[model samples]
Target: MTFWFHMNGVGIGSLKVYTNDQSGSRKLAWQRVGRQGPDWNQGHVRIDTDVQQVIFMATTRFHYGSDLAIDDIVMDPNPLVLTTVSQTYPSTASQTYPSTSPPRRYLTCDFEINLCGWEQDGELQWELKRGASPDRTSGIVDDHTLLGGRQYAFFNGHKAVNSSYVARLDSGQVFFQPGVNISFWYHMNGAGIGSLKLLQRTPYGNVLSLWSRTGRQSPEWLKAEVNLPPGLYNLTFEVSAQHHFSSDIGLDDIVLSEETIS
Candidate 1:
């Protein structure tokens, strides 16, 4: 049987799949396959292993120093686990709560109109981001945006690095893995992309996704169903992103859950 480990979450999106053999002690181990997303994904090490369990981990780090609107993490290890039932955002007065997880946001031009980033309210404020422009909102309702930017986010020989520039998301402990569906209200522009995905691969070799981007560009927020891939995952509303800045993409009301096929 194909056991899928699924998980999904907002902010520093991550999905930790612990495959402990039936021994209840034997941990799961996965070899390197590939990568996705525009984050600084790290490599995985046999962090620890013994007659008890073997543990291998991959880390994804966002570059574009801006908070993104991530909703879930899905991985299909055995059954599936996606969609965050409920969460509590502590301190409404703070932008980042409990600065534990390093910020997963890295930009290119630092913003000014030349470059843009993500946000929590789906707003883009580079300057307010630290070393760019001011905290500004998208002047346009990019339900169908056409962003035009270079491809800085990609999977490397084993490391997915947006070395120079990449998208961003809030900093916290949010993960996705071993699931079947991830619903995100995404918008796209007319531009195109090499690939736009909900999953961002890293060197450690892991699939942190719940319906990701392998292709690029779409004019509307349509649902995407991924069957043949690292695993099975689907989308409710059709959504697309050419993985380009000019392709203007925005995702809102994202829900990571199983979309009934009835």
Candidate 2:
């Protein structure tokens, strides 16, 4: 059995699953007795013998504000095989179910032909340009998509009247499952570089700041990744300039895919 669960404010409470048969009852799974955030997490359990019933229960010592939720429970007759994948960042090891599961790519954009589905949301817009930015001192010298051949999105800091001037690129509503991977290449070069923020706006009008980077980075493009939770949300890439021509920022090769499990 496989399912998705979210736990919140469970200070001393525990969530458990059990399988019962003619032989007896056995605990199948249980969550740590602590507070887990709103992030959706995957759970799996295997039953070897014939089971008459499956049960999910929550027990708590303090019942004031504890919350435990579960969803997307799937029971397959076929046996499931688990595999381990080595990861350098985020964690040292990760688990993947069903070794044949392949990552599903949801979106991929190079900004070579157009902005794809991305839209300009603020007054200071993201411009599609090739090679260096207008000022040539800040921003990327070549697009990360094709080195010197293709185009990329650039925010011209030269036009900013003040340091508060922001350029926003928004990806309209998209559906994402739990544990999706969002990645992109960004260039923040120049003496006057400012800040870049990645935000997630939910359907209920709640906005969450996922990631942010301030100040100037390396002259070459750098990669960034965000592990997004399950939801239908809009993604916003916001850049604020330092009111200098060299404060420009560049973004390229945006991609979103299911978390790779190998």
Candidate 3:
């Protein structure tokens, strides 16, 4: 099974999986998983035994800087728990909210021309381009995108101590739906050491991290999904890199809707 979580920083703890033996004694199946630095980490463990439960233990040298958050736990074929029935978002809507009283819109951004009015900031270089080239000589194309198009959010690492970029919605947007979810396509490739985080801003100016992943997830574009409570919220997309000039990260097709998949 594979699980995703936000470690925030290094030296946190470990997650253990356990199962019962034939003698009815509890035995450890797998143990000790952690991510380096402050970012999200995806962990995978193969259990030969019939797993019973999982446990998380903090090491003796624990530094309580950031809390651990886990989400989107997945196995190859299926999952342990189901969250939603289906996943759908209205892509054609111009505005993020519905014209009616109850609010019925699915916000979308393809990065064609920055029509969505998203804000950008931080150290890592971010821009909209047709696509990135995968080459070593030019040192430009660190990774290839899964979605082929005329434009996508291309995040490139530069020669700097800190490398990061943030794309977010401006504050004070009203969302009246009972349930809402945010989804996007991201391609984190190459030999870079960085992390991507999906954050939500509340009405009281509080920022809450909902989902994240670190390092090279895959060569192809991967979908990241997160559920939000019914209320007003501002979304922020953040990518940070530790090593300079490692590789490039690509983001495209962002959607916010009242749908999810279990």
TM-scores for the candidates: 0.29, 0.57, 0.52
lDDT (Cα, tens digit) per residue for candidate 2, span 1-262: 6677666674537667778877876654333344545576555554444787788887766776677788999886653212223444565456443222212221367876555555555647677778767666555778875547788888888888888888777665555555566789999988888899999987577988999998889888999988876666677899988766688788989876656423
C-alpha lDDT of candidate 3 relative to the true structure: 0.54
Flag the better candidate by TM-score, 1 or 3.
Answer: 3
lDDT-sorted candidate list, best first: 2, 3, 1
lDDT of 1 by residue, 1-262 (tens): 1122222222233333344654576443322222213443322222222234434354444533323222233332342222323335675542322212111121111232222222211111111111111112211232212343312111111111222223333211223333323333443333332234554433344545535553434545555444312232221112232332333344433333333423
lDDT score for residue 19 of model 1: 47
Q: Relative to the unseen true structure, what is the C-alpha lDDT of residue 62 in candidate 3, on a scale of 0 to 100?
A: 64
User: Which lDDT value does model 1 have at 22?
Assistant: 49
lDDT of 2 at 183: 89
Tens digit per residue, CA lDDT, model 3, 99-154: 32211222366766542435333433356666454424332332234345557776
Q: Show model 2 residue runs off by greater than 4 Å.
A: 1-106, 260-262
